[model samples]
Target: MHNPPRILAVDDVAENLEIVFVRLQAHGYEIITAADGEEGLARAREQKPDLILLDIMMPKLDGISVLRELKHDESLGFIPVILLTAKADRADVVAGLDAGADDYLTKPFDQSALVARVRSMLRIKALHDLVQDQAEKLAEQTKELAAFNATLEARVSEQVGEIQRMSRLKRFLSPQIADVVAASGDAQSLLESHRREVTVLFCDLRGFTAFTETAEPEEVMRVLNDYHEALGELIDRYEATLERFAGDGMLILFNDPLPCDKHTERAVRMALDMQATIKAHASVWRKRGHELGFGIGIALGFATLGRIGFSRRFDYSAVGSVTNLASRLCDEAKSGQIIIQTRAFHAVEGLFEARELEPMTLKGFRRPVEAFEILGAMKQEEKSAEA
Candidate 1:
C-alpha cells in the first residue's frame, strides 16, 4: 500500500467523474476516472487501486455486473468497492451489497463522508496486504523445516546402521580391540594393507581331526563350545586381536591394529594360560571318553596384514612367513606342548622357562627352524616387574 492510496471513480456522466477526480485528488488521493463499467474494470485491473467507486447506471456494463465480475476474480476480489446509485431505493442498495459491494452512497455525494469511507477502506487493504505477506513467509519457512527434518532422519538412519554393523563385527573381535576399532575415525584405514612386526600365535586341538571323525556332531559342537568359551576369555584378557577361529584353530595377533607393549611377553602369557585351560578341559574330555589336546605355536616377525576378499566376504588377516612358521610349528607340536621359534623365544627369553628342541626342518622352510617348548612361566612377582 502506498502513502497516497489510488482510487478508481467510474460514472457515465462527465460532471460526476470530474467532481470525484477533483475532490479526491485535492485530498491527497490519486484518482483514476473511467466513463463506463467496462472502462472502470480495465482501469481497476491496470492500477489495482485500493478502493473503487462504481456508478450504478452506466453504458456497456452496470455497476452490479462489474462488482460481480470483480468478486469472482481471485486477484481483484478483495479490493473494496463502493457503489454509487441515484435511485435511493432499498432494492438497488440491497442488490449492490449482495453483489459484494463494501458500501454504497446516494447521488449528490457528501464530501466529508466520502473521505472517511475512503480512509477506512484503505486501512483495511493495508492490513490485508501485511497479513498475506506474513503468511507467504511462514509457508516458506515451513517448507525449509520439512527439508531439514528429512535430512536429519537420513543421517540418523545411516549412523544407526553403522552401529548395527559394528555390533555384528563385535561377535568376532576382542572387546579391548573392538573398542579401538570403534573409536577410530576410519575403520577401513585400520584394515588397509600394511606391513608390521606382529606376534602371531596359532593353536588347535592335538586330536581334533580324529575326535571329530568318531564323535557325534553334537559332541563335537559341545567340546568346541567349551573350548572356545574358556580360551575366548583369556584372549580378551590379554587384549590380543583374534584374527579368525576355524573350528579349533585360532590365529591371534599382538602389536597390531593398535600397538601393544611387550607384545611377545603377552603372547607367551596367553599361550601358557591357554595350555593350562586346555589341560583342565582334557580331564573332562577324558571322562567323556573323547580325548582332545590343545597345542600352540607362537612366532614374532614382520608380516603383511589387512582386509582380504571381496566386498561382502572379507576379513582382517595376517599373511607372511611369520604366520606360516607359526602354523607349521603348531603342526609339529605334541599334545599340550606350546612351541616357539628361536626368534620369538629370544624376544621373551627369561620371562618363561623353555627347553630347546633339536633342530628339525619344518615344512616350507629351507633351513631347520630353531624352536623351544615352553615349560613354565616366571614367578608372579617377577612377571609383574616385567609388566
Candidate 2:
C-alpha cells in the first residue's frame, strides 16, 4: 500500500490553516497544521513532511527564520519550502528567497494555484528521494564488487603457490606422484617414513664403466645424456617413480606413493619399452665405434620409503632387501636381458614369457635367490587365456 505525500502548513490564522487542510486533503495529500513558526519547525522535524507551506509574519520565529533554521539542519535541509506571505513587497519576497525558500504565494491564494504548487513540490521531492536511493544502491554494489575482487586475488595466490610446490616436487618425483601429492595438499605426509610392498626396477648399460675410462669426457657425457633421455621418456610413460639416476644407472619404483594393481606387469612392460628404445641408440653408438648394451632387474617386496637429505635438497628413496636384490640381479644380467626375482616373476608369470634360471648366490643374502629371465610380453590371446 502506498502512503500519500505529507504537507506541513504553518499559519497564525485559523481560517488560513483550515483552508489549506481542506484544499490539499481533497487532492489526496495528508496535511499537518502548525500555529506558529516554532511549532512548524518541531512538526517538520518530527513528521519529516515532504513539503512545507510556511507563512510569513508568524507571532514567534517568523517564516524567514524558520526557513533559515530548516536549511541549516542536515536532516531537514532537503525538504521543499514554499513561503506563503500576504506582503506583496518585492523586498520581503527577495528576503524569503535568499533564506532558501523554494517557492512563494502572495495574499489570498487561489485554490487551483495552491494545489498546483503543492503538486510541483511533491514531484520534486519524489525525484530527490529516487536519486538518493539509487546513490545508496550504487555504493552497496561497489562495496560488494571490491569484496569479490579481494576473494579472487586470494584464490589466485593460493593456486599459484600450489603450482610452484608441484613443480618442485616433480623435479625429484615422477609427474604422477607429484600430481598426487599436490592434489592431496600434503607433501609432508608422503615424506614420512613408511613401509609398503613396492616393485623396484634397476637398469644400466653394460660396459659403461669401461667406456667412460677410455672415452673423452665430452663424448661420455653426450652418450650418457642420450641414454638417460631415452630411458626417462619410457619411465614417465609408465608413470614409474624415478628414485635416482647416477650416470648410466637408474632406479625406479612402482606402487608406493601411487598404488597400482598391476605394478609388476607395468614394470615388465616398461623394461621391454626401454630395451626397444635403446636398441636404436645402440646402433648409432656402434657406428661411432662405441660398444654399449642395456640390462634391467626387477623385484617386488616390502621396503621402507621416505624423503632423504636436508631441507635444501632431498630425494624420495626406498631401502630394504628388495632394493638390494634388484641391484644384484641387474649386476648379474647380461646385455639385452631383463632379470626378475622369484617374487616379481610369480606376480606377472602369465602376462609375460620368462625362462627359469638356476638359483644363484647374491650379495647380502644368506641363501641362493631364485631368479628368471624375462623374454617378452605375451600376445593378447595368450594373456586372456591365462587370465
Candidate 3:
C-alpha cells in the first residue's frame, strides 16, 4: 500500500504550528511540527518530507535562511517550501521568492487556501517520482534488447559457418552424405574405420585404353568428360557413395556411410542406366570415327571402410576382398555387359532376369567364383503380381 505524503511545518509560535498541523493532518497528509527553524531543517533532512511550511519571523534561523539552506543541500533541495509571512512586509515576501521558496501563504491565511497549496505541491512530487520510475524501466529494457540482438548475431554466424563447411564437403562426398554429416555435426564418426556389408560397383569404358592411345589428347579428354558426367548423374540418382574415379574407371559403394535396403537392386539399375546413356553417345562417337562401349561389375561382401590418405589429400575408400573381386569382374566383363557375383545375384534374383555364368578363376581367390549376367529389370506387371 502507498504511504501518505509528509508535510513539515516550522513556526516560532506554538499556536501557529498547532493550527498548521490540524489543518494539513485532517486533509490526509502526515504532518511533522517544529517550533523553530533549526528543528525544521533537521526534520526536513531526517524525515525527507514532501513539503515544508516555514514562518518568516522565527527565533533561530529565519524562513529565508532556512529556504536557502534547503535549496543548497543536494539531498534536501527538491522538497517544495512555502513561506508564511505578514502582509505588511512585501520586501520579505520578495526575499523569500529570491531565496528559492516554492510558494507563499500570508499571515491570517485561510484554511482552505493552505490545504489547496499543500495538495498542489504533493501532486507535482508524485509526477516527478513516476517519471523517474519509468526512466529506470526503459533503461533496463534497452539492456535486455541489446543482449537479445547479440545472441541472434552469434547464432547466424554459426549457421553460415556450417553452410560453408558443407560446401567444402560436397566437393569430396555425395550431396546426401554431405548433408547428413553436416546436420549430425559428427563427420569423424562417419569417417572412422569400420567393417560392414556393402554392395560395391565398378565400371569403365571397354576400349578406353586403346582410344586414349590412338585419339588426340583433346578428343580423349572430351570423351572422358562425357563418360564421367553420365555415370556421375546415375550414381547420385541411386544415392550411392562414390569411392574413387581414376581415368575412365569409377568405383561406387552402397549401404555404407549411409544404409539402403535395396542396395543390390540400386546397383544393377544404375549399371543398366549407364549402358542406356552410353548408347545415345555411341552413334555420335561412331560418326566421329571412334567406337566406345561401357561395362560394369557388382559384388556384395563385408569390407573395412574409412578415410585414407595424407593431410593435404584423402579419400573415403573400402579395403577388402569384395573390392578386389568387383575390380576383377569388371576387367573380365565384355562390352555392354554387367557381371555380378553369386551373392549379389541371389539378392536381386526375383527383381531382374539374370543368366548364370560358368564358374571362372579370378586373381586372389583359391576357388573359381560363380557369376551371372543381369539382363534387365522385370516388367511392372510381373513384379506387382509376384508381390
Candidate 4:
C-alpha cells in the first residue's frame, strides 16, 4: 500500500548524481544520494533503502567491493543492488554480478531504462515483505489455537471425572440404572414418574453411637471405610444402585431406571451377602477388642421416585410410605438379622434361605404386617428343598 520506494544512488561524479536523482525522483521514488562507494554502503546499512544504485569505479572502496560487503552482512544481504559502470566490459559485468549486484547498468544508460529497473526491483521487494508478514501472523494464530485446544481438552477430562464420581454416588441403583441417570442432563427427571415396582434395602450399623463415643475418630473412620468397601463391591457385582448414605446406614434401590424382573431376588441376595460379610468382619473386630454389628431390612412396593431440593443442589431419592416402613423395619431389627416384609418374602422366598417372623403393626400402617427373616442366599437345590 505504501508505494514510495526509497532509492540510494551512489556515484563519484557530481554531474552524474543530478541526472540519476532527477530521473528516479520524477518517478515518485524517495531518493538518497552518496558521492562514493564508502558513503553508499554506510547509507545502505543505516537507512535500509528499497534499492541501491552502485557505481562500480569509485574512490575509497570500489562498487563491487562495497556490494560484496553489503551481501556478506546478513542483515543487509536482502537489499537489491544494481551496479553502475561507464565501461561495458563483459568481464566487469560478470564480476559485479558474482559480487551480489542484482542488475548492471552502463554509464550511457537511458534515464527511462534505469527508472524502470528500479521500479521492478522495488515491486519484488514489496511482494516478498508482504508474504513474510502473512507467514508470521499465521504462525502466531496457530500457536494460540494449539494452546486453546489444550485448555479445552483438560476441562473435558475434568468433566468426565466428575460424571464418574456422581455415578458412583448412585450405588443404590443398578449399574445400568446409574449409567442412565448419569447420562441424563439432570437427576430431576428421575422424580416425575408413576409408581413402579422396586426393591428397597436399608442397613443400619448396630451401636454406632457407642462406637463413635469410645473409638478414636480415625479408628471409627477406618472401620466404617472397611465396611463400605466390602458392601460397595457386592452392590456393584449385583448391579444395584446405592441411593444415598444416611449417617451410619445405607439405602439401596433396584428396578427403576433399568427394570429387572428379579428385583426382589436381587434385594434378598444383597441382604444375605451383607449379613454374611458383617459376621465375618465381626470375628476379626472381636479379636482386636472392637465390636461391630449390622441390621438389614428389605421391602418391595411402588415408590414415588424423583429428584428433590433446590435446582442447584438436589438429590435423587424415593419418597413414599414404603421407604419409611423400610427404615422402621431396620430399627426394629436386632443385630445380625435380615428383616423383610411378607410380600417381599413371597416374591423371592424360593431363592433365599428364609424363615417366617412374627407379624407386627408398623407405624402409620392400618394393620399389623406379616414379616420374615432372611437366613441367607439359597442355592438352586436349597430353593427346591424349600419349595
Candidate 5:
C-alpha cells in the first residue's frame, strides 16, 4: 500500500533510459531520469533515491566514474548502485566491480531479471537506511540521558556520591571507571591490592562567567542536559568508567581500578568525541536558538586507591595529583578545546592526531604544564565523488 521506492535511471541515450524507466514504472515504482552521469550524480545527492540503475557509457561522465564518486562521499557511499550496461565481457564486469558498482546487468536483459535486481537492491537499501536511522536515534537518546544526568549532578552531588558507591569496594576502586567492580567486593578490599596504571579525564563547560551573565537559568540547564547526556552514551560505547561529575564538569578514569590497555587512547577519544557531539547538537539548539561551548582535560598516572569519608556520609572518588591536575587542566582549558598533559598525550599519540597547545598555568600548580589538543581520529577514509 506504501508508495513504491524511488529509482534513478541514468543513461545518455534517451531510448535506453526510456526502456528502463518504462519497465520499472510498470512495476509501480516512481522513476526519475538522468540522461548523463553528471546529472545522475547531482540527482543522487539531491534526491538520494533508494536505487540507481546506471548505464556504463554516458556523456560528460561514465557509470564507472559515477560509482567511484558515490562510494567516496560519506553521505552517499551507502546508496546502492547497479550497473545496467551492454558490456557483458569479463573485463567489463571486472572494471565495474573495481569501480564499486553493487551489482551489474548486461544490456538486452529480461524485464523480470531487471525487476528482480531492482527489488533486491531496494530491499537492502531500506534495511540499511533503517539501521542508520535507528543508530542515530539511539545516539540522540543517549545524549539526552547524559544531558539530564549533567543537570542532576549539580543538585544531587551528595546523593550521587552515596548512591553510586553502594558497596565499600566501589568507593576505592573509583566507581566512575568501575564497570565490573561489582564482580569484586567492597572498597576496603580494593585498597589491599597494589595500584594500577590508569588515565583520568576531566571535562567542563568553559565560559561560566559569560553564560551566567548572558543566558537564562533554563537555557543554561538545557545546554548542560544535552552535553552530559551525549557524553554518557559515548563513554559507555568506549567502555570507559565515569567517576562522577564535578559541578558542570565530569571526571572519568580509564584503565582505572581496573586495567584497560587502551585507557590512554580511550580518554583522548572520549574528549574528541564529546567535542564532536557538542558541535553536532549545537545545530539542534540553534534551530531552537542557543549558544554553547565545552572544555576537556586528560591526565594519566598511577595513584593510591582507597575510600575516605564518614561511614554515614561515604562516597567513592579518586584522589592524588593526577586527579587534581586533570581537574585543574580542564578549568584552564579554552572553550571547545581538549587539553591533555604530556604524559597523557604520549599514551594516545600513536592512535590520534594530537597537537600541542601552549603550556598552561594552574591555580595550585607550581609550573606551566605541557598540554596537547586532539585534532581527530586517524585518517582511514578517502574522499570520493558520488552520484
Candidate 6:
C-alpha cells in the first residue's frame, strides 16, 4: 500500500499557511503546517515530507535559512522547496534560489501551479528511492559471493596440501601405512617422542665401502639403485616402517606409528626375504665384476622413537641401545647371514632354524650380548610333521 506524499507549509502569516494546507490537502497530499522557520525545520525532520512550501519573511527564522539548513542535512537534503514572498524584487528571488529554493512566487501562488510543482518533485524522489533500494540489494549479493569464494579457496588449499603430504610420505612409508598417516592429518602427534618395544632391523651391503672406493660414481649409484629397488619392495610387502637409509644400509622398524601382532616374526620374515632377494641381485652384479652381499640384524627391545632432523630433512628414528645393538649385530654378521638378538630369536624360534652364537662383546654395552644366526624358514611340511 502506497502512502500519500506529505507536504509541510511554513509561514508566520496564518492566512498563507492556511491557504497552502487546504489547497494541497484537497489535491490528495497529506498536509502539515508550521508557524515559522524553526517549526518548519522540525516538522520537516519529523515527517520527512515529500515537499515544503516556505515563507521568505518569517519572524523567528526565515525561508532562506530553513532552505539552507534542509539542504545541508543529508537526511533532509532531497526534499524539494518553493520560496513564497510578498516582494517581486529580482534580488530577493535570486537570494532564495541561490540558497537552494527550487521555485518561488510573489505575494501569492496559484494552487494549481503549486500542486503541479509538488507532483514533479515527488516523481524525482521516487526514482532516487528505487535506485537506493537496488544498490543495497546488489551490495548484499556481492558480499555473499565473496564469502563463498573464500570458503572454496580454503577447501581447495586443504585438499592440495593433503595430496602433497601423501606424496612425501610414500617416499619412505609403504602405501598402506602412508594412507593411514596421511588420513590422520596429525603427523606431529603421531611422530612425538614415545617408547615402545619394537623389532629393529639394520642391514647393509657387506663390502659397500670398498665397492664405492673402487667403482666409478655412476657405477656406484647404479648398484645402489638396483639394491634399493629390490629390497624396498620386500620392506613394503612386509609393511615395515623404514627409519632411515644411508648409502647401502637401512634401519627398519616394526610395531611403531602403526602396530602389528608378533612384530618380531614380521621383522625376521622380511629379513629372510631381503637376504634371498639380494642373493639373486648379487649374482648378477658379480658377472659385471662387482661383488656385493647383504646382511641384517634383528632385535626386540624398547627404544625411544620420534621425528628427528632439521626442517629440510627429517627421519622417524629410534634411539637408545636397542638400535645400537641391532647395528652391532649387523656389523658382526658375515655375508649372507641374518643375525638375531637373543630376545628376538625366542619369539620366532618355531618358525625359522637359527644357531645360537657364542656371546660377543659389542660396543656401547657393559656385557657380552648373546646372538643367533638365522639359516632359513622351516618348510610347511616340516613344521606340520614336527607338530
Evaluated with lDDT, which candidate comes out highest? 2
Worst 10 residues of 5 by lDDT: 378-387
**For residue 198, what is the lDDT in candidate 4?**
82
Q: Higher lDDT: candidate 3 or 4?
A: 3
User: Where in model 4 is the C-alpha error above 4 Å?
Assistant: 1-107, 110-130, 133-176, 184-188, 191-194, 382-387
After best superposition, candidate 3 residue 9: deviation in angstroms?
A: 6.2
lDDT of 6 by residue, 1-387 (tens): 026888888999999888888788787888889998999999999889877888899887888899889999998747778788999989889999999988887777777787777788778777777777788888998898899889989988988988877776776678788888877878668887999999999999988899989999999999999998998898888888888899998999999877789899999989989988999999999999998888898899999998788878776778978989999999999999999999999998778988999999999989999999999998899889878
Question: Please, what are the lDDT tens digits per residue for candidate 3 over residues 1-387?
Answer: 027888889999888888998888887889888888898888888999888899988888888888889999998646778899866588998999999988899988998999998888788777877776788798898899889889888988988978877765665567887788778878778877999999999988878888888999999999988887887878877888888889988889988786779898889998888889988887788898888888889999999998888877667889999999999899889988999999998999888878999998998899999999988888899888888
State TM-scores per candidate: 0.69, 0.75, 0.65, 0.63, 0.49, 0.73
**By TM-score, highest first, what's the ranking?**
2, 6, 1, 3, 4, 5
Candidate 5 residues 315-355, lDDT tens each?
A: 44666789888888888777777888998888766566668
- How displaced is residue 280 in candidate 2, in Å? 4.1
Which candidate leads in TM-score? 2
lDDT of 6: 0.87
**Which has the higher lDDT value, candidate number 1 or candidate number 5?**
1
The model with the greater TM-score, 2 or 6, is 2
For 49-119, candidate 1 gives per-residue lDDT tens digits of 88999999898999999999999888774798888888899999999999999998898879888878888
Clash count, one per candidate: 0, 0, 0, 13, 21, 0
The per-model lDDT (C-alpha) reads: 0.88, 0.90, 0.86, 0.81, 0.77, 0.87
Determine the backbone clash count of candidate 1: 0
- Residue 146 displacement (Å), model 3: 3.6
Cα displacement (Å) at residue 89, model 3: 15
lDDT (C-alpha) at residue 339 in model 6: 92
